[model samples]
Target: MSLTLYALGVAVLLSASFFYLFGYRSWRRRRVMAKPFPADWQTILDRDVWVYRHLPEPLQARLRPLIQVFLDEKRFYGCAGLTVTDTMRVTIAAEACLLILNLPLSFYDDLRAILVYPSAYRVPDIHREGEVLSESSGVHLGDSWQRGKVILSWEDVVAGAGHHQHGHNVAIHEFTHQLDQADGSADGAPMLRSSNALRTWSQVFSKAFDNLQKTLEQGHSELIDPYGATNPAEFFAVVTETFFERPRALHREHPALYRQLQQFFDLDPLSWTRAGD
Candidate 1:
């Protein structure tokens, strides 16, 4: 009887091991397949003239293929009487591509869908309060989920794209959240390449975040948007918009912060902004 029990236990262990290996192998295959964007996708990307014109030559080249992947696999939705237009699609794609232009294209592999609303729409029932309490109520311009969906308001998106100095771009802000979420948490820092880079990033961002918090507490108007004072994640996203949109002013006021962003993004928007057509 003892021998029979031991043999049965061994068989069960072997079966479990087989299932684990099979599941792991399947997951690995799917991950590898997700890396390469489909061919013939450039045609879809080329339809956008504004993105082609505004982005720098090097950035454009890098962005084209990444945007193609976004167009191919990502699902898009229109809600709250919103209509998804070609121009809106191009704008959102362009902004999102900017985030991954310098890094591996597979960084955004998990992203599978985009949902757009006509304007800021309310999300009812985020939490159950037994009485259906509408506790978290606001007009959100954009939101990114951990499960691969990005939500945006078309009106806010267009406005943000058109006005460079406003320090508000729903597309950039939500996609930045996606980047932060890539590491399974939406803490301030995203995945960096080297230890040195990580160290420098933490030090610079910590100091800047603390200062921004203090400035907000003091009830002072800051050069960067006060919304950045919301938290570390929002601060990173807000500063990113300023870095690209108002580079000269950011550099003049917060030189060290600008330098940190330059190292992280590996591009000088100040140069791009200065060399205007």
Candidate 2:
């Protein structure tokens, strides 16, 4: 062969090999991500994921793959001498996935790990206002951090999952905070699509939050948790719990706020029958 022909043949061979290797790696990565759903995890989901069982068949079908992805990606740590089991992981993943089921989600990209306790956990109740700091002991069911960690009590998780009628789910509450903190702050708002959407969100959220505070100040019971009046961040989390757990009440009491949440979440819980249905 001529020297030029030999050189060109070598170049073509190298190019073909490079493309083949790249394609193989891409296929391999996809296969790894598309791992088969585990039978034990499915059993756990069937038994412990109460909210999931209540979802419509279509929604459940849609959510199962996402739950699989979430389980595959995130890490779970047992705290307070608790041993994290497939049940714990599935239960937590199911509730957390419910929030993002109808929305575009990267599977809570900011969160790296979930820390669970066997029961209520204690933390330093440190209050920092400017330069002043006061420390005390406080008990919590669950808490989420901006630095990619969520702490939960497994007892609370089970209770919240099993009792959707109570409008209290520690898993839902804390994970909502994770979504709120996705944009670097747990300031009540999550990542929205546009400036206009943000403005609408601010107006609707601020008005409802103020009304909740007013109702609390008047010493009358409110439909949503009064703890929501704590701050905009907590208000968002607290109302989220109510929105999913007690959608009918939220809609009847705070129609505008419920509509806003419905728009943001892209789901209508009221349309579907509850667990018994």
By TM-score, the best candidate is 2
Enumerate residue pairs that collide in model 2.
none
Report the number of clashing residue pairs per model: 0, 0
Relative to the true structure, candidate 1 reaches a TM of 0.77
- The digit string of per-residue lDDT tens for model 1 on 49-78 reads 334455677877777656655666577888
Q: Which candidate leads the pack in lDDT?
A: 2
In model 1, the number of clashes is 0
Over 1-277, each residue of candidate 2 has an lDDT whose tens digit, in order, gives 6999999999999988987766654555466447777788778877877777778889887677778767776899999789999889889989998999887655387688999999998999989999999999999999998888999999999999876868899999999999898888889998886888889999999999999999999999988899999999999999999998888888888888888888888888887745432
Q: How far out, in Å, is residue 51 in model 2?
A: 1.4
**Stretches of candidate 1 above 4 Å error?**
1-52, 125-136, 275-277
How accurate locally is residue 21 in candidate 1, as Cα lDDT from 0 to 100?
64
